[model samples]
Target: MSDAGDKVARIRELNDNFRKTFAGGMMMMTASVAALPEMVRSAAWLKVSEFDAWDTGNDPHHEHDFINFELCNRNFFWKCDYYAPDMNSGSEDPSDPEKTVRVGLLMLAEDY
Candidate 1:
């Protein structure tokens, strides 16, 4: 392959690796906290005030750094806005007794 072609291939590989590493870490963290139901439940209400796990802007992304997106229920991973209604918001009211909360994987982007 030409130099340009090789570079493109490497970039693609890096992107794939970035996505996988972020997803895996999120899953593991979720699993580890599985034993604590209350903690998991609390995670729902807790907004990610500060998180920079992935450096999406950087070219040479490492295993510990990449780009990611987080959703309230993983049902809306594509949605970037946090103000959007979550899946639970549709089924039951947060103030009601039938509340069902789920932890979402919010992607940590860099600050401008």
Candidate 2:
């Protein structure tokens, strides 16, 4: 990370790319989320990809790293965490994409 502003911007951009494109990272689903019917899971995933309701309440850090929403009357959440390239520890600098690996989870809010 560099200056606070630049660091936040970089982190936010990286996180948005992972969330929107599911590229540059991996996303895992909780067992309950994985067990959902295909169509429902698809819809829920679509919601996750489309989520952009950010503000002080849900995204206080402004990193675009996590959100919760309702799908089929069930609450669900998606979140991202930054790790080292080897996945053995937290990244030294989350804003440095080259030194970081992004991992995310999509699961029921209840499982959060």
Lowest lDDT 10-residue stretch of candidate 1:
75-84
Clash count in backbone of candidate 2:
0
Global Cα lDDT for candidate 1: 0.32
Q: Report the Cα lDDT for residue 34, model 1.
A: 39
Q: Candidate 1's residue-wise lDDT over 14-55, tens digit each?
A: 334333443211222334333345553345324232233445
Quote each prediction's TM-score.
0.24, 0.95
lDDT of residue 22 for candidate 2:
89
What is the lDDT for 62 in model 1? Answer: 35
Model 2 Cα lDDT, one tens digit per residue, 1-112: 4699899999999999888898998988999999999999999888888888899999999999988998889999988999999999999999998999999899998898
Q: Model 2 misses residue 35 by how many Å?
A: 0.4
Q: In candidate 2, residue 48 scores what lDDT?
A: 80
- Listed per candidate, the RMSD to the true structure in angstroms reads 16.4, 1.6
What is the TM-score (0 to 1) of candidate 1?
0.24
lDDT, candidate 1, residue 7? 49
Candidate 2 lDDT trough over 10 residues, lowest sum: 44-53
